[model samples]
Target: MWTAIAGGIQYIIDMGASVMLPIFVAILSIIVGVKPGKAIRSGLILGVGFVGLSLIVNLMNDQLGPAAEAMSQRFGLSLSIVDIGWPGMSPITWASELAIIAIPLAIAINVVMLLTKLTRVVNIDIWNIWHMAFTGVMAYAVTGNIWIGVLGTAVHAVIAYKLGDLMAPMMVDYYELDGLTVPHGTSSYLAPVAAVVDFIIDKIPGLNKIDFNADTLQEKVGVLGEPVVIGFILGAAIGFLGGYAPDQALPLGINMSAVMVLMPKVVKCIMDGLMPLSERAKKIMNEKFSGESFYIGMDPAILLGDSQVVTAGLIFIPITLLIAVLVPGNRVLPFADLATIGFFIAGAVAVHKGNLFRTLISGILIMTLTIWIANQTVDWVTAIGVTTGSIQAGSVIAALDQGGCPISYVFTQLFTMQNVTGLVVIGVLYAICMVFYVNLSKKRAAALEAEDDEE
Candidate 1:
C-alpha cells in the first residue's frame, strides 16, 4: 500500500510542471469558492502561460547552452564537471525515493506552521517541493539515515516558508505582486546574501547613492537604451564572444530581443489568471483568521518578467564566467544556468529596489557563493544523477540551483561531519545574513502596512 501511494505521487510529479501546476491551481481555486467554470478557465490560462514560459526558456537554453559551451572552450576555463541546472536536476530529484513523500511532508509542515502562527505563508507551489525533497535526499545519501533526511526536508521547508513571509512586503512594494510571495528555489535560500550586501552598502556614503537600471539607460540614450535594443546588443556580443561570426550572432541577437519582448506578455496571462484566485483566497483567509494577512507562496519565475531582471541576467552571462575563473578551486563551468540567471538575482533586485548597481554587487556575491557550493556538491549530485540514470556512470554533475543550496549543504555536513570548519564558517555567515534579512523584511512589512493605513 505504501509503495503504491508513493508511486502514484511520483506519477503525478512526472507529468511536468506545465500540467501539474495547472491542476493544482484549479483545485485550489475551487476550494477557495471560485465557480468551477471560472476556476477551470483560470487554470487553463495559467497552463498557457507556463507553456509560453517553457517555450521561451527552451529557446534560451537551446541558443545559449552551446554558445556558453563554446565560450568556455574558447577561454580554456578549465572547469571540468558539468553544472546541469534545474532542467536536469528536477528529473533527478523526482526520481529519488524521498520525492514521493516529500510533497505531503512539506504540505504537512506548512499546515502546522500556519496553525501554530509560526509562518503566514500558504505555500501552494507544489511543483517546487522538489527543492525540499532534494535537500532531504542529499542528506539521506550522505549519512545513510532516512530519519536525518526527513529532518533535513522539514528544516528546509520551514526556512523556505519563513523566507516567503519575509520577502512578501518587498514583493508587493517593488514588484507590485500583491498577495503573492516566492518561497521556492535559490531565490529564497540565496536572498540573505542580498540582504547582507544591502546592509553593508547602507553603511557606505557615495556607493549607497549609486543607482541604475534599464529605465535609467533608456533615459540617457532614448530608443537605443530600450530593452529590445539592449537585449539585441547583449545577445550579439555574447554570441561574438562565443566565437560566432556576425552572420550567426545577429539571429541569436534577434531571438534574445524577442525573449525580452515576449516574457512579460506571457506573465500578464499568469497574473490575469491569478488575480481572481488571489482576491478570493485573501477574502476567505481574512474572514477565517480574523483579518490576518496571508501570502500565497509561488515560484520565482514571476519576477523574471521585470525588465531589470532580464537586463541583469544578460549582463551576468559574462560576469558569472569571469567570476568562475577568479574563484579559487571552482570547477563547475557556468553553462546551463547562464540562460536563466535572472532567477538567482530576481529577489536581490527587489531588495535593492531595482538599483542595478547594487544588484550587480550582490549578484557577484550570490553567484560566487553558488559556484563555490556547487563545486563542493559535485560528488553528491553525481551520485543521485547516476542512480536516476540521468547521467552515465562516473559522470560528475552539479547545479547552481538546489544542488548548490546552502540549506542542503549545511544540514548534510552537520550530520556527515565532513568539513567541520567549512560548515562552521558558512553556518555562521548564513545565520548572520538571516538576522539582517529578518530585520530588513520587518521594516519593509511595517512600511507597507503604514501605506495601507494611509490608503
Candidate 2:
C-alpha cells in the first residue's frame, strides 16, 4: 500500500510543475470555497501562466547560459564544478525517496503552525515544496539517517513560512502584491542579508540618500531608460563580452527585450488566477477569526516581473560570474542560474524599496555567499545527482539555489560536524541577519498599519 501511494505521488510530481501546480491549485480552491467551474478555470489559467513562464525562462537559459559560459572561458575563470542550477537540481530532489513524503510533511507542518498561530502563511505553492525536500535530502546524505532528514525538512518548512510572514509587508508595499507573500525558494531565505545591509546603509550619511531605482533611470535617461532598451543593451553587451558576433549578440538583445515585455503579461495571468482565491481566502479567514489576516505564500517568480527586478537580473548575469571568480577557492561557475538571477535578489530589491544601487550592493554579497556555500556542498549535491542519475557516476555538479541555501547548509552541518568552523561562521551570521530582518518587518508592518489608520 505504501509503495503504491508513494509511486502515485511520485508520478504526479514527475508531470512537472506546469501541470502539477494547476491540479493542486484547482483542488485547493474548491476546498477553500471557490466554485468548481471557477476553480477549474483558475487552475487552467495558472497552469498556462506557469507554462508561459517556463518557456520564457527556458529561452533565457538557452540563450544566456551559453553566453555566460563563453564569457567565463574568455576570462579564464577556471571554476571546475558546474552549477546545474534549480532546473537541474529540482529533478534530482524529486527523484529522492524523501521527496515523496516532503510534500505531505511540509503541508502538515504548515497546518500545525497555522492552527497554533505560529505562522499566518498558507503556502499553496505546492510545487516549491521541493526546496524543503532538497534540505531533507542533503541532511540524509550527510547523516545517512532518514528520520533526521525528515526533521530537517520540517525545520526548513517552518522557517520558510515564517520568512513568508517576515517579508509580507515589504511585498505589499514594494510589489503592491496585496495579501500575497513569497515563502518559497532562495528569494526569501537570502533576503535577511539585505535587511541587515539596508540597516547599516541607513546609518550611513551619504549612502542613506542613494536611491537609484529603475524609475529614476527612466526619468533621467528618457528612451534609453526603458527596461526593454536596458535589457537589449545589457544582453548585447554580455553576448559581446562572451565573444559572440554581432549577429548572435543582437538577437540575444532582442530576446531579452521580449522577456522584459512579456514577463508582466504572463505574470498577470497568474495573478488573475490567484486573486479570486486570495480574496476568498482572506474573506474566509477574517470571518472565521474576527479581523485576523493571513497571507498566501507563493513562488518568487511572481516577483520577477517588476521592471526593477528584470533590469537587475540582466545586470547581475555578468556580475555574478565576476563574484564567482573573486570568492576564494570557489569552484562552481555561475551558469544555469545566471539566466534568472533576479530570484536571488527579488526580496532584497523589495526590502530596499526597488533601489537598484542597494540591490547591487546586497546582490553582490548574496552571490558571493551563495558561491562560497555552493563550493562547500558540491560533493553532497554531486552525490545526490549521481544517485538519481541526473548526472554520471563521477560528474561533479552543484546548484546555487538550494545547494547554497543557508538553512540546508546549517542543518546538515549540525549533524555531520564535518565543517565546524563553517557552521559557526554561517550560523552566527545568519542568526544576526534574522534579528535585523524581523525588526525591519515589524517596522514596516507598523508603518502600513498607521497608513491604514490614516486612510
Candidate 3:
C-alpha cells in the first residue's frame, strides 16, 4: 500500500506543475467551502494558465538558449566543468531513495507547524519538494545514512516554511501579490541575503536616495519603456550579437515581447483561483484562532511576471558571462540556467522594494557568490549525478542553481564540517538579519491593522 501510494504521487509529480497544482487547488478549494463547480472551474483555469505560462517560457528558452550558447562561443567563454543546470540536477534529486519519502515528510511537517502555530504559511508548492529532497540526497551521499538524509530534508522544509512566513508581508506589499507567499527553494533561500544587502544599501548615502523602478522607467520612456518593448530590444540585441541577421532577429524579438505581455495575464488566472481560497482561509483563521492571519505559499514562477524582475534578469545575462571571464578561478559558464536569472533576483527585487538599480547591484553580488560556490561544489554535484545515474561515471556535471545556492552551500558546509568559519560568520549575519526581519514584519502588520481600523 505504501509503495503504491509513493508510485502514485511520483506519477502525478512527473506530470509536472501545470497538471498537479490545479488538482491540488481544486480539491483544497472544495474542502475550504468553495462550491464544487466553482472549485473545478478555478482549477481548470489555473491549470490552463500554467500551461500557457509554460509555453511562453519554452518559447523564450528556445529563442534565448541558442543565442546564449552562440554568445558563449563568440566570446570564447569556456569553463572546465560542464554546467548542466537544473534540468540535470532535478532528475538526480528525484531519483534518490529519499525522494519518495520526502513528499509525505515535508507535507506532515507543514501541517504540524501550522497546527502548532509555528508557521503561518501552508506551503502548497508541492512540486518543489524536490529541493528539500536534494538536500537530503546530498547529506546521504556524504554521511551514507538514510535517516540523516531524511532529517536534513525535514529540516530544510521547516526552514523554507519559516522563511516564507517571515517574508510574506514584503512579498505581498512589494509585488502586490495579495495573500500569497513564495516558498520555493531558490527564491525563499534568497530572502536572508537580500535583506542583509538591502539593509546595507539603506545605510549608504547616495544609494538610498535612488527610487528607480518599473513605473519610473515607464514614465521616463513612455511606451518605449514598456516591458514588451524592452523585451523586444533585448531579444533583438541578443539575437544580433549571436550573429542572427535581421530576418531571424525580428521574430525572436517578437517572441520575447509576447512573453512579457502574456506572462502577467497568466499570473492573473492563478491569482483568480487563489484569492477566493485565501479569503476563506483568512476568515476561518480569524474566527477559530482569534484573528490569526495566514498565507498560501506557492511557486515563485508567478513572481517573474513583474517587469522589474524580467529586466533585472535580462541585465544580469551579459553581466553573468562577464563575471565568468573577469572573476579569477571561476570555472562555470552559465548556460541552461541563463534564462532563470529572474529567480536569482526575485527576492532582491522585493528586498529593494522594486528598485531596479539596487536589485541589479545585489544580483551581481549574489551571482558572483553563486559562480564561486558552483565551482566549489562541482565534485559533489557530479558524484550525486553519477550515483543516481543521471550522468555517466566519467562525465562532468555541475548545477548553476543548486550548487550556487548560498543557503544550500552554507547548510551543507556547516553540517558536513567543511568551511566551519565561513558558515559560522554567515550564520551570525543571518541571525542579525532575522532580528531586523521580525521587527519589520511586526511594524507592517501593525500598520495594516491601523489602516483597516481607519477604513
Candidate 4:
C-alpha cells in the first residue's frame, strides 16, 4: 500500500506541472469556498494558460537549441561533461526515494510556518518542491542516511519561505505583482546576489546614471522597441549568427515574435484564475489575523512576460555561450536551459528597477558564477545521474542551472564535507547579503508606507 501511494504521487508528478498545478489549484479553490463549477473552470483556465505558456516556451527551445548547438560547433567549444540541463536533473531528483515524501513534508512545513507566523508566504508552487527533494536526495546519496536527507529538505523549505518573504516587496513594487511571490529555488536564490549587485551599482557614479528599461526603450524607439519587435530582431540575429539562410531565419524570428506576444496573454489568464482566490484569501487572513498581510508563493515564469527581461535574456544567450568557451575549467555548453535565461534575469530586472543596462551587467556576473559552479559540481551531478539511472553507467552528465545553483552547491559540499572551508566562506558571504537585503526591505517598506499615507 505504501509503494502504491508513492507510485500514485509519482504518476501525478509525471503528468507535468501543467496538469498537476491546476488539479491542486482546483482543490484549494474549493476548500477556500469557491463554487465547485467556478473552481473547476478557474483551474482548467489556469491549466490552459500553463499549456499555452509551455507551447511557446517549447517553440523557443526547439528553435534556440539547434542555434546554440551550431554556435557551439562553430566556436570549436567542446566539453567532456554533457549538459543535459534541468530536464535531466529533475528526473534524477524525482526518481530519488526522497521524492516520495518531499511533497507532504514541504507542505506540512509551510503550514506550520504560516500557523506560527514564521512566514507570510503560502507556497502553492508545489511543482518546485523537487528542488528541496533534490537537495535531500543529494545528502542521502552522500551520507547514506535518510534522516539527514529529510533534515536537509526541511531546512531548504525554511530558507525558501524566508527568501520569498524578503523578496515580496520587490515583486510588488517593481514587477507590479501583488499578492504573489516566487519561492522557486533557482529564481529565489538569485535575490541576494541581485540585491548585492544593485547595491554596488548604486555606489558607482557613472554607472548609476544610465537609465534604460522597457518603458524607456518603448518611449525612445517607438514601435521598434516593442517586445514582439525586439524578439523578432533578436531571433533573426541569432539565427543569422548561427549561419541560417534568410528563409530559415524568418520563421525563427516569427516564432520568437509569437512568444513575446503570446506569453503575456497566457500570464493574464493565470492571474485571472488566481486573483479571485487571492482576494478571498487576503480578506480571510486580514479578518482572521487582524489585518495581517500574506503572499501566495508562485512559479517565476510569469515574470518572463516583461519586455526588458526577455530582451536581456535573449542578449545573454550568445554571451553565455561565449563565456562558457572562454572561462577556464567550464565544461557546460548551456544547452536545453538557454531558454531559461529570461527567468534567470527576471529578479535582476526587478532589482535594477527594470534598467536593462544594469540588469545585463548583473546577469553577466551571475552567469559567470553559475558556469563556474556548474563546472565545480560536475562530479557530484554525474554521480547523482548515475545513481538514479538517468544517465548510462559510464556516461557524463551536467546541468547548467540546477547543477550550478549556489544553494545546491554549498549544501551538497557542506553535507558531504568535501570543502568545509569554502562552504564556510560562502555561508558568511550569504549571511551578510541577507542582512543587507533585510535592511533594504525595511527601508523600502517605510517608503511605501509613507507614500500610502500621502495618498
Off by over 4 Å in 2: none
Which of the two, 2 or 4, has more TM-score?
A: 2
**Would you list the C-alpha lDDT of every candidate in the order shown?**
0.88, 0.92, 0.79, 0.81
Q: Each candidate's TM vs. the true structure? A: 0.98, 0.99, 0.93, 0.96
Give the lDDT of residue 1 in candidate 4: 98
Of the candidates shown, which would achieve the greatest TM-score relative to the real structure? 2
lDDT string, candidate 2, 1-455, tens digits: 99999898888889998889889888988999999999999999998999999999999999999999999999999998889899999989999888889999999999999989999998999889999999998888767899998999999999999999998999888999889999989899999999999999999999999899778888999989988898899999999999999999999999999999999998998888887688889899888877888999998989988999999999999999999999999989989899989999999999999999999999999998899999999998987777666778877888999999989999999988889999999999999999999999999999999999999
Candidate 3 positional error at 81, Å: 2.7
The residue ranges of model 1 lying beyond 4 angstroms of the native Cα positions read none
TM-score of 4: 0.96
Output the lDDT of residue 346, model 4.
82
- Specify the highest-lDDT model's number: 2
Question: Which residue pairs of candidate 3 clash?
Answer: none
Q: Could you tell me which 10 consecutive residues in candidate 1 have the lowest summed lDDT?
A: 382-391
The residue-by-residue lDDT of candidate 3 on 1-455, one tens digit each, is 98889889888877888898899888888998988998889888888888887787778667888888788788788776767677567777888778899988999999899899999887777878888888778777766778878888887888888888877877767887767888766667765666767778789999789889767888998998888898898888888877888999888888878878888888787777676667777787778878877888888887888888888877787788888777688788787778778888888888778898888777877777678778867776877877777778888777777777655666667667776775776567666766766676666567667877999
lDDT of candidate 2? 0.92
**Which model, 1 or 4, shows the larger lDDT?**
1
Per model, how many backbone clashes are there? 0, 0, 0, 0
